[model samples]
Target: MHLDVIIGVSKNNKSGACDVNDIEKLGSDPKVVELFKLKKDEVIFDDDSDIFITSGSTGKPKYAVHTHFSVINGVKGMFYYLEGMPNKENRRIILGLNTAHISGEGSGVLSPLVASMTSVFAPPVYNIKQIVQTIQNERCTDVLFLITYLYDMLNFKDIGEYDVTSLDICLTGGSNIPPKLAKDFEEKFACKILIAYASTEMMVPSISSPWDPLEARCSGVRILPNAEIQLVDDDGKCVPLGSNGEIWCRCCSNFQRYMGNDEQTKAAKSPHGWFKTGDLGVFNAAGVLSIVGRKKDMIDRGGIKIFPADIENVLSQHPSIEQVQVIGVPDERLSEEICICLRTKKNAIIEKDQIVSHLTGKVRLEESVPGYVLIFDSFPKSITGKIDRMSLTKQAIDRIQSKVQ
Candidate 1:
C-alpha cells in the first residue's frame, strides 16, 4: 500500500488496510514489501523481553527492535513527573493528531493511558475550525498536540467565545514550534504549555507539564530519570555545554536493535549502546535541552520527514520557475510545513498560487512541498557565499507563520 499506511498497518492492521493494488504497488519493490523483519542478534520480545522497531530519522529509516520493558520505561519516564498536575480526567479534550504520528499510538496513546487519562483521536486535516469545534463540543481539557495544531487552535478568531477554559495543558514538539506561535498560545490560553521532546527512540523527553516561560518553551526537553542524553561531535566525544552537537541517548526505554539492517544498526547505535537521535540540541544552564535543528537534511511536515532537496530539484524545472530553495516550517498538522523560497526569473512571472497549483499537479512535491513559498530579492549567503539554507529555512518558516496570525 502507501508508505504511510505501513505505520497504520503495523499498529492496527485490521480492515485489510492495504488492498490488492496496494499490494501490487508494494510487491514491485523488495524494499517496499519487506519493511520489518527480525534480526539475527535479537529475537522478538516475549514473556522475557520487549521488542519494537526504531523510528528511522538519521540517514535512512530503520526498524529498531525493542521490548515491553522499554515501552514502559518510556511512559513512566514521561508521566512520572506529572503526579502534581491536577488530574483533569473530569473532562478533557485531546486533539489527537500527535498519536497518528510515530508517537501517536505509543506516547500519545499508551503513556496517557498509563496515566489513566482519556483522549480524543483527531485526524491530520488542517481545519482549524473543525479542531476548535471539537474542543468546544468535547470540552477537552488537555491537548497532546504538536505546535502546528496548537498554534492554529489558539488563533481561531472565536476561540474566546468557545468556553475553552476547560483546556489547561498544551503540549508540543513532535517537530519544531514557532516561538511566535508559542507566545501567542501562552497569552491566549493563560495556561502554561510544556513541550515534550523525544523520538522513536522514546517519546517522553520532557516531563509532561503545562507551559514553561518563553525561554523554556524550546522542545527536545531535558533528560528524564530513566534516560541519559549526550550531545556529541563527529568524533563521538561529548561536546561542551551550549555547543551544537548530535544528540545521543542511552536509555532503558530505547529500542534494542534495528529490525533487519545490520548497517543501520551499527550506524544508529554506539559501541556503548547509545542510540543516536540525529537531532541537534544544546543544554541550558539548568540542564534542560533545547533542540536547535536536525543533523539530517530533512524537513518535518507535522511529524513526517520530507527531503526538500528531492522536491526542489523537481520544482525548479517548472516552465514558470527559475531557482528554488525548499525548507520546512512549523505546521499545525505536520510539525513542520514545507516552504519553498525562490526567484521567478522566467519570461512570465509565476503567481505564488499558480506555483502551488503547478506543483500540486505536475511535481513529486504534491504532498511534500511546503504549504506555500517565500519569494525574495535575494537570499542570505554564508561567508563562503553559499546560500545559508538553515537561515533561509528559518526565515521562510517565520515569514509564513507570521502571516498565519
Candidate 2:
C-alpha cells in the first residue's frame, strides 16, 4: 500500500520531510514517486485511496480508505472547533502520540499541517516529565492526550514547578474519561479538558465545545458539524433520545471502506452509510453524547451485564488509584467475573478489602464490585497508547490460574 511506503519513508526521514534527492538515495520506487506526485500536484485522492491501517486495538488490523473530500472536510471540522478557542493565528500544540494511528495522524500531524500551526512532538515513548518540559520550553498553546496521560500527569508531583500558563485548551478521549481526573487536571494545570468522540473509521464526530461548563467537560461531547449520530439497541432499532445504545455515526469524513475486508465493512456499515462504532453512548437532553463503555467489553456475569466504565469511573476517584482497567474472566458459577487491574499512585498502599469497600456503594450495582483486584506497577498498552485490554485479560487469567495451582 502507498501508506506502507510512506510509513517507511517517515521512519528514515526524522526531519518529517522528504525530497527527490532523499527518495533517490532510498532507491527509486514507483509507489514513492506516486506518493510525492500526489503531494506536489495537490490533487484530491479518490474514494478508493487506501490511506491508514487501524491500530487493531479491537481485533485484527484493517486498512481504511480516505478520499481527499473526507480529509479536507474533517480538517474543516477541526477549524470549526478551533473557532471557539483564543489565539486563532498563533496556535502551538504538543503531539505525544503514535502517528500510525488515526488519532495521532489526524490531531498530531494533519490538524497542525492544515491549520498551519507549530507542533512540538513528544518523545516516541510517552514521558510526563518530557511532555511537561516541552510545553514549558515551547510555550505550547494546546495539547491532546489519552486519558492515561492525564493520570500520569496528575501523579507527577513536580508539575507545579512548570509554567504551562500558555496552555489555553486541551483534549482527551479514546475511552471513558473519568470526570474526577479531568477536574483534577484542570485544577492543577489550569487548562480545560475537552472530551472528544472519534474513531479511526469516523474522523471526528463530536467534541465538547471550549465554552462548555467545567462540570460538563468530561461528561459528554457536542456533536460536530456535518455529522449525524444515532443510538441503537442490539436489535438494530434506534433507541429513544437520552437512552443508552451503540453509537452509529454518519459523516462526510467517515471511511469509505475497510480495505480488502468487505465482510467487516458490511458488518460495521449500514446500506445508508452509518458506521456502528461498537461504543455505547447516551444522549443528554441538551444533545451532548456521553460514551459509557465499549459494547463488546461488557462483562456478563450470571446474565447480569456490567459496563467496565461504570466501575472504572468510581475506582479512579480513589486518591490512591492512578489507573485502572476492568475486564471479565471466566467463572464457573458466574459465567464471567469482574477483574480490576489497577496501577496505584506513588507510595500509595491499597488492600483488596479497601477496594471492595470503596466500590460497595459507589458502583451502579452490587455485582459491579470487582471479584478480583490485581495491583500492578503498570498496565500493558497497545501501540496506540491505550490500555491493551486483550493482553491484560490474558495476564489477569494467568495470574488467577497460577494462584489456583
In candidate 2, position 81 carries an lDDT of 75
Tens-place lDDT digits, model 1, residues 1-405: 115553232434667476545566765777764553434246543323433433332333445555767777777875575444576356354655534344566656766676677767654544667666777688777776654466347546777667667677776565555444566576787656777777765556455334455645544365678878889998999999888788888887777665556877788788998888877778868787876666765676655556554466456566555456676666666676667787665355767667666567544554534577678766764322235666776687677768878
Please give the range of 10 consecutive residues that has the lowest summed lDDT in model 1.
50-59
User: What is candidate 1's TM-score against the reference?
Assistant: 0.61
Clashes of each: 26, 0
lDDT of 2 by residue, 1-405 (tens): 433333233345655455546656654677877778778666546545436776667886788887877776676677677655566568888887777677777777777776677777887777899999999999988898988888777778798899889987787888878778888888877888888888889888788877778778678889887799999999989999888899999998888888777899999899999999999989988898888888889999889889888888888889898888889999999999999899888899999888888888777665546789898888887767788788889899999999999
Per-model TM-score versus the true fold = 0.61, 0.89
Cα deviation of 277 in candidate 2 (Å)?
A: 0.8
Q: What C-alpha RMSD separates each model from the true structure?
A: 14.2, 3.9
